[model samples]
Target: MSEPVVGLVVSHATLAEGLVQSVRQIAGAEADALRALSNEGCGPEALQKSVRDALGDGPGIVFTDMPSGSCAFAARRLTLDRDDTAVVCGVNLPMLLDFVFHRDLPLPELVDRLVSKGKSAITGSCREVAGHGDRAAAG
Candidate 1:
């Protein structure tokens, strides 16, 4: 069997830690497949080092809270030369949950799945609720 893919959550402040906690709460035994990194009071270089240290030489996915933020920047910088690493931005609970269930997929396929799932998970409240009547009524 293929080795299980590792997950790295990077975000500003305590967001990464909190997200990992939520993942652990929901994922149960599968939580060991993931780790979290916080950029709180840390410079870009420090953050990059931390992420690299967490990743080591293994295959993993880095989830960032924002596409244009430092966490994403660090993640991108660290994974640029590595084919075994992927960075997925705008991470939410749905995306992380998807990763927990599908981490065994190959790196490229897993990245694709995460990007798709993350984008699909963002929807207006009306759209999120099926049979919620007309948009005007919902508003």
Candidate 2:
């Protein structure tokens, strides 16, 4: 009955900026939807308030870049008090695109889909080499 929410927390301005274009192309991820965790060259909570403020009274998801980073911790803390919010770490373009494309899906369902796609996108060194080798084999 309400619009979904999505936010991002990044380690650095440069890395965040780098993801902007790719996110735009895949998921229509917006600049306004992103929050920098290290503004003023300080710690994590700097962007938490801004992110919370941006999502005022809305039920949606938050995406953080690293699992062990402060951004993820802060996000976890924020959502701990709210039943309507979901925070996911290690977010990638495929996950975002899946979320955007399947916007009509239920919240829990969206989370599962995003996680599934995101995990599947991860490839180890051997897997990467094997994938290329398979391509070469086909050719």
Candidate 3:
């Protein structure tokens, strides 16, 4: 069997930590491959080092909270040095959940799947439900 790709969640404040904790909650032991890093009180170099340390030397997918920020900056740098690493920004719970279950896929395919899953998870319908004055979102 192929080696499962690791997942690195990098974000501001405690977002990264919270996401990983929640993933562990829902996925249990299977979500062990995913780790979290935060730029709460660190500079660029420190954040970069933390990201590298969390990612190690294995093939990994770095999920950043935003497309343009410190988290993305650190992860994007890794891709230039290693082909096995990928950066997928704007992460969500659904994306991480999908990733934990599909880590065995090839790096490129896994990244693509993550992006799709993340985008798909962002769905909502806020409209007037026939006769309701208050705005309601359909689930």
Candidate 4:
């Protein structure tokens, strides 16, 4: 098999580490390919370098906690000229779990699957779960 697609999770404070820790706790061996970086004391340039050093030369994804946050900005900047890597915002436990298991897939395919898995993991409201609009309103 080819080299597994690794991931660098970047988040504010200790969020990144917490997510990676959770993945390690739950996924065990499968979580080996994922790492974490926090933007706690790092500025844009520093964050960028930290991410760059962590990623090196490899086909991987950078998972950011927010779409418009420092982590996302840094990751986006670092990967602008690279095709082997991609930046994924809104990092979460479900997404990380998906990444750990499906790392062997091609980069593009892996990105698609990770995004899909991440989106699918999001859910809210019991009313929405049951039904919405006229049907739920009447019932």
Candidate 5:
């Protein structure tokens, strides 16, 4: 069986390097994470080629740093007309960590779980102060 792959796409090579380091810092040894990014003097096509070369006909997931940027676009193109691979943008620590943590799950289930976790990770807090600020004074 092929080893499961998780790839990252970034706008710049330096960013890609940092992502590799950060992913390892967060995920430890749970996954084989690779990266593709636009080089200092290159363009979006460079990112696309990087992804294609790294994936090389494998069942893998690609995560891009931006939802509507070159990196994301490249990943989308790479996985076009293919289901074995998934291209997900909005890459963040939570999502990447979740992917590695749940690597053992079956693909379909994993995807469902990841989406749920991703949504939950985003927060928008709006509430009145509780015991520490209001309720204690009220009661």
Candidate 6:
């Protein structure tokens, strides 16, 4: 069997850690396949080292909170020469949940699905729904 794909969440401050905790609460046992790292007070070099240490030598995915921030930059730098690595920025609960469910997919396919799911999850409410109505309209 193929080695299981690993997941790494990288973000500024405590976002990465918090997201992982939330994922654990929501996903239960499935969240065990993931890890989180924060660029709290570390420089690029230190952050890169942390990511590399987390990644080890296996096929993995890195999710960042920002596309151009330090976390994404470090992740991009680390995966630049490695085909087995992929970095998906703008991570959210939807994306992480998708990863939790789809971590066994091939690296490239998983990255594609993550990017699509993450983008699709970002939406604006245009009208009232069954359980979700605009509070301003109600008040």
Question: For residues 1-139, could you state the per-residue lDDT of candidate 6 as single tens digits?
Answer: 5787888999988898898998888888364488999998899999999999987788999999988979999999998877789998899998998888888888888889989999888766554453465343332
Candidate 2 residue-wise lDDT at 96 = 68
Write one digit per residue (lDDT tens) for candidate 4, span 21-59: 999999894544988899988988999999998987878
Which residue pairs collide in model 1, if any? none
lDDT of each: 0.85, 0.65, 0.88, 0.87, 0.65, 0.86
lDDT digits (tens) for residues 1-139 of candidate 2 = 5465554545445555456556776666555554333433645566667566655665667777778666667677778788878888887767766766665566788788889999987755566577665453431
**For candidate 2, what's the RMSD?**
3.8
Question: Per-residue alpha-carbon lDDT of model 3 for 47-126, expressed as tens digits?
Answer: 88888888989789999999998999989987898888999999999999999999999998898898999987786443
What stretches of model 6 exceed 4 Å from their correct place? 30-32, 126-139
Ranking the candidates on TM-score from highest down gives 3, 6, 4, 1, 2, 5
* Alpha-carbon lDDT of model 1: 0.85
Clash counts per candidate, in order, are 0, 0, 0, 0, 0, 0
Q: Which model is ahead, 1 or 2, in terms of lDDT?
A: 1
- Per-residue lDDT, model 6, residue 28, is 88
Task: Assess candidate 5 and give its TM-score to the true structure.
Answer: 0.70
Highest lDDT scorer: 3
Per-residue error for 134 in candidate 4, Å, reads 26
Model 3 bad stretches (over 4 Å): 129-139
- TM-score, candidate 2, is 0.73
Error of 6 at 45 (Å): 0.7
Q: Distance from true position, residue 9, model 6, in Å?
A: 0.5
Tell me, what's the RMSD of every candidate? Answer: 4.1, 3.8, 3.1, 4.7, 5.3, 4.1
5 or 6: which has the higher TM-score?
Answer: 6
Indicate whether candidate 1 or candidate 3 has the larger lDDT: 3
Model 3 steric clash pairs? none
